[model samples]
Target chain A: LFAATTVMADPLPSWSDTEVKSGIVAFVETVTDPASDDYVTPSDRIAVFDNDGTLWGEQPVYFQFIFAIDRLKTLAEADPSVLSSDVLTAAAAGDMETVLAGGHDALFEILNATHSGMTVDAFQQEVAQWLEDTKHPDTGLPYDEMTYQPMVELLRYLRDEGFKTYIVSGGGIHFMRVFAQEAYGIPPEQVLGTYTNTEYAMVDGEPVISKVPGIAFVDDKEGKPINIERTIGRRPIFAGGNSDGDFAMLEWTTAGKGPRFGLLVHHTDGDREYAYDRESPIGRLVDGLDKGPGLGWTIVDMKQDWQRIYTGQN
Target chain B: LFAATTVMADPLPSWSDTEVKSGIVAFVETVTDPASDDYVTPSDRIAVFDNDGTLWGEQPVYFQFIFAIDRLKTLAEADPSVLSSDVLTAAAAGDMETVLAGGHDALFEILNATHSGMTVDAFQQEVAQWLEDTKHPDTGLPYDEMTYQPMVELLRYLRDEGFKTYIVSGGGIHFMRVFAQEAYGIPPEQVLGTYTNTEYAMVDGEPVISKVPGIAFVDDKEGKPINIERTIGRRPIFAGGNSDGDFAMLEWTTAGKGPRFGLLVHHTDGDREYAYDRESPIGRLVDGLDKGPGLGWTIVDMKQDWQRIYTGQN
Candidate 1:
C-alpha cells in the first residue's frame, strides 16, 4: 500500500503570479532553508511592515486623519473654542487641500489637543469605539476591514516561515495597539510606531498613565529606521512599505550585511481600490519607486500583482 | 520491586528558604497552574524586571554611571576640550558628589558627547568592549559577572514556568541591549530602558543609525510605567524592582484587574554586596519599602533571603 503525503496550497493565495510574489517567495525560501548559505535563525527572522498604505487602504487620506477629523467635529460641537485651530478650521470646512498643506506639525497639534490629557485606557477605548462605529467614507467598510488581502496573507506567510512580523508605522503606537492584534495578528509588543509622551500619575487613588500633548517621536521617513532600531534592537531581514515614508526603512534593511528583502507595494489598482502614487500627497510613493529597482527592491504592483484588493471583497 | 523517585530540588537554588523566595514561588505556581483561580495564559504571563539594582548589584553606583565615568575619562584624556563640560570634568576628576549633583541633564549631555555621533553598531561594540575589559571597583569581577545569582535563577525559573521575562531599566537602552541576553537570557527586544534619539543615515555608501546625544525618554520613576505601557502594551503580571524608581511600575502591575505580583529586591547584604538604601542618594528604597507591606508587595531582603550573591562568587 502506497501512502500519499498531504500537500499545502499557495501561501499567498491573494497574490498573483507576478515578479513581486516570486521575489518574496524566493527570499523567504532561501533564508529559511537549512542548507542555504543565507539561512537565518528563527529568532533573527524579523519582518517589518508599514501599516498605512502598505497593510491597509489609506486612500483620500490616512484613517488616523479621518479619526482626527471626527474628533475635531465632536469637539467643535461640544466646545466652540475647537473651531479656532487652523487645521480644525480647514477640516470643519471640508476642504482637504488646506488641511493637507498644514503638514505634520498641524497634525501633531490636532492630536495633542484631542488625544492628550486623557488616560491611555480612555484613549484606547475611544480609538476602539471609533474603529468599531465608524465606516470608511469611500469603501463603506469598517476602517479595520479595509486592510489589504494580499498583504495580510504575506504577513501570515512570513510568520509561518519563522519570521516575527512587526508593524513599524507612522501611526500612533497607542492608536494601533487598540486593534493591531485583532486585525493583523500582530501583538502590541511587536507594533512600533510614532509615539507621544505619557506620564504616570495617581488619580483618585488609582494608578493611571496620562497622554501628554506634543509628539515624542515620528516613526516615518528616516525616523522609521531609527525607531525600528530603538524598539526592536535588530535589523529586520524583510521590510515592506508603500510610500516615501518607508524609504529609509527599506534602505536600512537592504543595506544590512546579510541576506535581506525590501518590498514596495505600489498602489496601481484604481478600479478595485484607490490608486495614487508618486503624486499623491498622502502615502506618496515617489523616490522609493524611482530608486527601488537599482536597490534590488521588489516593487509590488497592486493592480497586476494582487488578485484581491481586500479580504472578503475578492 | 521498589522504585526510588529522584526528587528535583528547588528551582531557585541561590535563594534561601525565606519569605521572599516562598512568595515568588507561590505567585508563580498559582498563575501557572490551570486549576488555580490566578491562572494566566502563557502569552499573557509577562514579567518585567528593573536592571540596575533589582537584577544586579548597584552599590557603589549604577553600573551605567561607571560606564559613563570610564567613557568620560577616556574622552578627557584624548581630547582636553571634553574637560570643559562640567559633568565630564567632575566625573573625570573622580568627584562623585559634583558629578551626581549635575543630575540626569548632565548625564544626557555627557552621553551625547561620548555616545552620540557614533553608529549604533559602533556603540554596541564599545559597550561590549567595556563590559569585557572593565571590572567592578571593589569586587574585581567583570561587570557582567556581578549580576545577582538569586535573581538570575529567579529569571530562569519564571521562564521555565512559561513567563516572558523583560528588562525595564533606567540605564541606557543601547547599553543594556549589549549584554542582556548573555547575562540574563533576556533578548534585546524584551529589554526596555531609557533611550536617546538616533538618526538613520548613509555614510561611505553604507547605512548607519547614528546615536544622537539628547534624551529621548527616561525610564525612571513615573517614566517606568509609561515606558512599560508604551513598549509592552499589556500590563505585566509580575514586576520586580529595587528602588522608588520601580514604585510606579510595581503600582501599575499590582493595580491590574486580575492577580498580579510585585517584588522589591531590598539590597540588605552589605557584606556580600553594597546595601545602602532609603537614605542613599542612588537607588533610594524608602517610599516603596514603607508602603510595600500594606500593598502586599514582596520585599526580598538580600542579606536574609539570598544564599548566594554572584553566580560564581557563591
Candidate 2:
C-alpha cells in the first residue's frame, strides 16, 4: 500500500517521461521476478552516490568550503592571531580570488589552523551544530534542506527495492561522518571521504581523539573507484554523480561484469540552481557527458526532469 | 547436511577446544538466522584481511621483496651499467641488511629499478604467472599455495556467512590485484594495498598503463585504518591480521559501535612453521597480543589452535 501510494502521488511527477520510465522499468524488471533476465538478488543490489552537487547544491561555493570559511571567521574573531588580517578579510568576504591566490599551500595553512587542535568528537559536534542553523546565502534555506528532492526520492526508492546505498564523497571523513546519517538516512559508517590523521590521547582523565592536519588521502577522480572497491568490497550496481570528479567512479562501476547503471546529474537549471559546466571550476561535467553515451550512462537534466529542486519547499 | 560434511572434511580437525568452539560459533552465529542479533545483513557483512602473513606465509622473507630482489639481479645481469656492484651483490644474496643499509632512499632506488617501466597489465600477468610455479624456499610448495590453512578456513567461513571479503595489505596494490582473486576469492577490485603511481601512455597508438616509481600510499600501521575508511566507507564487521601492521585496523574495527570482531593470528609453531614474534623481522605480533585482551581481541595461537598450517600434505 505504501508503494502504491508513493507511485500514485508521484506518478512520475517530477521526472521527465523518459527518465522516470527508464529508471522505474529497469529497477522493477531487475527485482520483480527472479526468473527474468534482469533479475538481481537483493544482495547484489547496491547503489553508491556522490555527495556535494549530486545530492545537494554546490553553487557559488561548495557547502563544505563555505563551512570552513565561516569557521575561519569565527575563530579569527576569537583570536586575531589565528589568521592574518588579509586571510581573515578574504575568508569573511568569500573572495575566491584572494583566498585561492595563495594556492594549495595557503589553503593548507588555513585548514590546519582551523581544523586541527580540536578533538574529533568536538569537531563533529561543531559541524553538526553549525549545519543545523547555517543557511545558503541565496536560498536562505538550511544547507541540509537544500538537498535535491528527486535524488532523495530516488535514494528512498532504491532502498525500498532492497538496494544498500552508500555516500562516497571527497569531503573530510570525520566531517561528513558527522551529519550524513541524520541528513541522508545513510549512516555515518556508510559515508566515505578524505581524512586527516587522528590520534588518541588522554585529556584530563578521559580519552580524546584529536585531529591532526596534513593530507591523508584524496578521494577525487580516479581515487573514487579505488576507495569504493577498498571500502565497499563490491562494485555497485548503480552509481550516481554530478561531475567529472565522479567520472572514474561511473567508469569503474560500468566496467564490472554484470548489469550496472551509471547516472549523471547535469546542472541545466540556472533559475533553480546555477548552471555552468565544462569550464566551471567546480562540478565540471565535460568529458563525462561526452563519454556517457558510449559508457551507457543515463544523464539526468535537472531542469527538464525535476520540477522541484530542494525538498523543504516541495 | 552440507555444513556437517564440510566440518568433517576440514583439514584442521584437531584444533584446540577453544579454537574450534570460537571458530564454529562465529561462523554458525553469523549464518544461521537472518533475524538473529549476531546475523549481519548480507550488505553490511564485510570482512577485511591482511595478505603478507595472514593469508600466505610471510616468514623467512616477504615474497614481494624477494621478487623485487630477483628482478634487480635479472636487470643487473642484463645491463651491468644500470646497477652498482654493491646493490647487485646485496640483491643476489637476499641480504636486506646490506641493501637497506642505504635506508628509505636506497630502497626506493632498488624498487624503481626493479618495478617501474613495465605496463601494469604486463606486470600483473607476470606476477600471476610467477606465483603459478614459484616455490617457497622452505616448503617447496608454490608460494601462492602456502596460505595458512586455518586462515583459509576462516575466509571461506566468513564468505559462506554472506560476508564480502577484502584483502587489505601493505604490498603493492597492482601486485596483489593479480593474485588476490585466484588465491583468496577476493576480486581485484576488493584488494587494497600499498600503491605506486601509474601513468597512462600511448605506445604505438595503443593505450598502456605503466607503473611509475613513487609511493602513492603505504597501507601499514595507522595507514591501514585510514585507507580502510577512505576506500571502504564502513568499518569492517570483521578483520584479521597476523602482525603489528594490522593493529590499527583491529583497533578501528573494534572501536566502532555495534557487533564487531577482531582477530590476530599468533605465530607460535616453529616445527610446523617458523615461529617468532616481537623480535622477528617478519610478521611481528607482540604489541597486539599484549594489548589484545584489553581491546577484546581474539588471539589465534597458531601452534595450539591449528591442526594444519598450509593446505595439502602439511
Candidate 3:
C-alpha cells in the first residue's frame, strides 16, 4: 500500500482531487499507456495552452495590455511625442476606462506604437526590464509571478509524461517568449501567438531583424485553430483555455478523432482570485461555460478546484 | 588505434574525407563538448538547412515548382478550366521553355491555382499522391528519393550530436512537410517555408482549416532570417544552403556572436548529378561561390566532396 501510494502520488499537487483533476490524469494515463488503443506516440502528444488567463492572471486588463501601456508611459518620458493619439494618451496615463472603451482598435494603436519600430531583441529587453521594475497594480507582485501554480504544475506533469507543451496565446509571440521558458517551462519555439511583419537587413556590417509595423496574423477565436494548424502541423491531443477567445481551439481539439481533452479554467473565486464569467471584459467566459460541457470539456471552478491559486499566495 | 577506429567510425559516411567533412566534424565536436568555451547548451544547438539545393537536388527548377506543375496537369484532367492562363497552359503541357521564360510571376500564377482553395490537409495529400505517382524526368527516380544522400547523413549526424535540425526553405511548407519526415527525418513544425493565408470554419460540426490565396510570408533570401527570428526565436548556431537565395540565411547565421558555421553545397558533379551552377537558371550558385568562401563558409564541391549523391544511385 505504501509503495502504491508513493508511485501514484499526485502529479498536479495544487489541483484538488476533483473530476477536473481526475479527468486530466486519466486522459494522460490512457494516452500514454503503450498497449492502450488511445495511446498517442511521443511526437504526436502535443498540448497547447492559452496564456493570459489560463496560465496567469488577466484581471483589470490583460497583463500584455498593461505591459504595452507601461511601455508607452516609459517611452513618453523619453519623448512625449509617442503619445500621438488620444488612445495612446489615455493608455499611457493608465486610464483603463477610456482605453477599454476604445476596444481592440485602441489596443492595436498603442501596441503598434510601443511594440514595433525596434529590433525584436531590443523590444524583448524592454519587456524584461519592465517586468523586473514594475509590479502589478492590484496584487503588488511582479507580473511574472502571476502564473497559476496548478497550471504550471500541469505543464510540468505533462512534460514529465513525454508530452511537448506549448503556449498558444493571444499575447504577442515575442512578449510571452521573454518569460515563457522561465515562467512555464515552455521554450520560445513552443510559444505561438499574434505576430506582426518583420524585416531582416544588414546595417553597419551587422545583421538586424526589426519588428516592423503591420499585422501579420491574429491568433484568437478562429485564428487560434488556423494558427495551430499552420505552425504545429498536427492537432493537439489536449487544449486548455479560460475565455470565449479560446472557444475554437477547444472545439477543434476535442472534435479530433481519438481520446482528447479540453479544459476551461473558470474564474469563480472573488476572494482567492477573481470571480467573473459572463460579465468580465478581460477574460470573458460565456460560450465556454454554456457550450463547453456539452462538448465534453471540463470547466475548472478555480475557487473549488485549486488548493492554491498562485505560488506564495496568502 | 583499434579503440579510436571503432569509437570514431566516420559519422558522416557519405561525405568524402575532405576539408569540408573535417571542418564540420571539428565544429560539432567543439560546440557539443562541455569543456570547450565555444560549447553551446543542448537547447541552443539549432541547425537550419535550406531545402532544395542544400539537402536535395534542385537542378531542374525547385522540386516544389515541379510539384505545382504536375498538380496543375492532374487538376486539368478533372477541370480543363484550370488552364485559364498562358503560364498554366505552358506548365501543364510540360513546356519548361515557356514556363522558364515566365519567371516567378508565372510560377506564382500556376501555384496559386493548384495549391490554394483546398484544405492544407488535402493539399498535403495531393503532394503525397503526386510523389507516389510521378517520377523525375531526368533522374527516373521517385521524387522523394531525390534527397541528397550526403546531406541526409549530415542531418542524422547533427541530430545524434544533440542538434535540433530544421528545414528553412523557399519551397512550399505544405509540399515539403509531406516528404520531409521520411526523406530528411525532420518533422513538420521544424520545417519552415513559404506559406499563404488560410481560414478556419466548422462545416457540419467538423472543424476545417483551408488554404486561401495570398502571400502571407516568403521564407526566401532576407525573409529567411526574419522568419527564423519569428518561428525559431534563437539564432541558429549553424546554417547550410546552396544558392544566392540562401546567402542571407547563412550570412545572418554565421554573423551571430559565437563559434558559428556556414556551409554551401556547390553542384560540381555532372556525372553522378546535374552540375551546372553559375550558368544554370535553377539552383544558381554565383553569389555563394563568389562571396561564401570570403565569409569563412566551406563550399562542398559535389564532385570532390561526396562519395554518394543520391541513395541507391548507379
Candidate 4:
C-alpha cells in the first residue's frame, strides 16, 4: 500500500522534477518491473551509501570527530591521563586547527584515546547519550536530526521496492549503530563502517565484547568496496556518496553488468547547507567530480535538486 | 503452509524424539511465541551455526582441505611450478602426514597456493565444480550430500519459526559459500569464515575482486562471536557447533540476556561415522565436553540421539 501510494504520487517530494530525480526513479522502475530485460531479483537490489556527507551534512567537520572531541573533554575531566599527550590536549579542547595541523595521525590518535578500552555496550551507550545531549555546533540541532531529508526518502522508497539498504561509512560502526535505526530506519546489521578489534570475555558470567586500543580496519578509499564485498558478499546494484572516499564503491557498484545506479550528492547549497567541495578539509570531492558523469552517474546538485535539506528544513 | 504442517507433525523427522530435539524446539517456540514473556521479535531471532562439523561432515580431514589438496593436485599437474616448495609438493600429492608434521603454517600455505591469485567469481566456480565432482572417500557419496539430515531439519524449523540462520565457520568463506545455499539453505552473506585480503580493481570496465595472498582474518574461536557482532550486529539467540573451536561462540551466545540455546554436536558414532573427540587432530572436543552441559548447552550424542546421520544414511 505504501509503495503503491508513493509511486502514484511523488515518491520523492523533496527531490525536484529534474533529470537526477527522473534518472533515479526510472532506474529503480526498470530494475523492479520484472518484465524488463534489466529486471533484478529483490534479493539482488542492494544499495549502499556513504554516511558522513552523503546521508547528512559534514560541513565544519565530520560529526564523528566532533563527537570524539566532545566525548574526550568529558572523559578527561575525570581521568586527565586521557589527555596526557599534547595532541590529545588540543583535540579534547576542540582546537580543530591544531588537530588538523598534526595530520591523520593526530586525528586517529584522538579518536582511539577516547574510543577504546571500554565495553562495546558501554561505548554504544556513550554514543547514544552524546547524541541525546549534544547538538551540532553550527546547526544547533541534534545529530540524528541532521540527516538529509531527500536521502531518507530515497532509502524508504528503495526499501519499499524490496531493496536492502546499507550505510557503508568511514564512521565508527558502534557509534553509527547507536542511532541508525531510529534516524534512517536502516538496521544495525545493515550499517557497515570502520571497526576496531574487540576482545570477547566472560565478566561476572556475562559475555562482553571489549573495545581495544587499535584500528582493525578503516572503511575508506578502496577499503570501502573491499569491506562491502567481505560483509555483504554481493555487489550492490545502487550506490551513493559525496566524496572521493566513496569513488571506488560507486565505481565498483556501477561497473557490474545490467542495470546499476550511482548517485553523487554534490554539496552545492552554500545558503542552505555549507558548500565547500574541492578545498574542503573533510569530504573533499575531486575524482568523483572529474569522472562520475562520464560513468553515467547522476550527480545531484543539492542546491537545485533538493527542495529541502534537513527533514523539516527548507 | 510449511510451518503449519511441520508444527503439527514432527518438525525434525531425522531425530528419534529425544530431549536434545525437545530442548531446541521448546527454546525456539518460547522466543517466537509473541504472547509469551520470552517472545523475541523476528529481527532479533538470529541463529548462528559453525559450518564444518556442525552443518556438514568434516572428518577424513576438513573437507575444504580435501578440496584444496584436490584443487592443488590438478593445478600442480599442469604447472609443476605451482608446487615450488617441499611442503607444497607433499600437500599437492595428498601426503597428509607430511602436511600435519609441518603444522598449521603448511596447511594454510597449501590453501593459499591453491586459493589466492584468482577472481572471487573464478574461485567460487572452482569450488562449485569440485563439490559437483568430488565424493567422500569413505561414503562414496557426493560432498554436498554429506550434510547432517537432523541439523538441516533444525535449520529449516528455526527458519520457519522466523529465525535468520547464519554459518560462522573455520573453513574458507569463498569455498563454503559455493555450496552453502544448495546444501544447507544458507546464503553467501550469512556464511562467515576465514577470509583472505582482496583487491578491488576495474579491469576492462569490469570491477573484479582479486583474492590476493595473505590471511585477512580467521573466523574461529573468539572470531566467531566477533564476526557475528561485526556482520549480524546482534547476539544470536541460538548457536551450534561440534568442537572446542565453537566453545567461545556457544559460551558467548548462551550468556546473553533472556532465554538462549547452545548446542554441541558430539561425534560419538564410530561405526556410522569416524568419531574421535578429546584428542582428535581435527574438531577436538575437550573443553566443550567438560563445561558445556554445566552452562546449559545441549550435547547431542550422535550415536544415541540421531536415528540417521547423513541425509539418507542411517
Which candidate ranks first by TM-score, i.e. highest?
A: 3
Model 4 clashing residue pairs (backbone): none
Worst 10 residues of 4 chain B by lDDT: B1-10
Model 4, B122-169: lDDT tens digits are 999998888888889999988888999999999999999999999999
Cα lDDT of model 2 by residue, A1-314, tens digit: 77766743443445666754467656656654688777778767878999988988887877888888889888878887776657556776678788778776766666776677887768878888888978889999988888888888788777877888888888787777776776778866578777776665446744345788776667788777766655554568788999999988887786666678888999999988888789888898898889986888888888888888897676
- Please report how far candidate 4 places residue B284 from its true position, in Å: 0.6
Could you give the CAPRI-style class of model 3?
medium
lDDT of 1 by residue, B90-198 (tens): 7788988886788867777777777787888888898899998998889889989888899999999999999999999998889999989989999889999988888
User: What fraction of the correct interface contacts does each predicted structure contain?
Assistant: 0.96, 0.19, 0.66, 0.74
Better of 1 and 4 by DockQ: 1
User: Across residues B91-187, which tens digit of lDDT does each residue of candidate 3 receive?
Assistant: 8999988987888788778878988998888988888988898888898898789889999999999999999999999988888899999999998
DockQ computed for model 2 against the true two-chain complex using alpha carbons: 0.17
Model 3 bad stretches (over 4 Å): A1-5, A312-314, B1-5
Better candidate by DockQ, 2 or 4: 4
Candidate 3 vs. true structure, TM-score? 0.97
> TM-score of chain A, model 2?
0.91
Error of 3 at A243 (Å): 0.9
Q: Measured with DockQ on alpha carbons, how good is candidate 1?
A: 0.86
TM-score ranking, high to low: 3, 4, 1, 2
Q: Candidate 1's residue-wise lDDT over A109-171, tens digit each? A: 778777887889898998999998999877889999988988989999999999999999999
Per-residue error for B49 in candidate 1, Å, reads: 0.8
The DockQ value obtained for model 4 is 0.76
- The sequence of per-residue lDDT tens digits that candidate 3 reaches over residues A1-314 is 78766766679999999988999999999999999999999999999999998999998778888888878888899999988889999888878889889987987888899889999999999999989998888888898998999999999999999999998989999999999999999999999999978888878999899988887778999989888887878999999999999999999999999999999999989998888999887888899999999999999999999999886363
- In model 1 chain B, which range of ten residues has the least summed lDDT? B1-10
Worst 10 residues of 3 chain A by lDDT: A1-10
RMSDs, each prediction? 2.0, 5.4, 1.6, 2.5
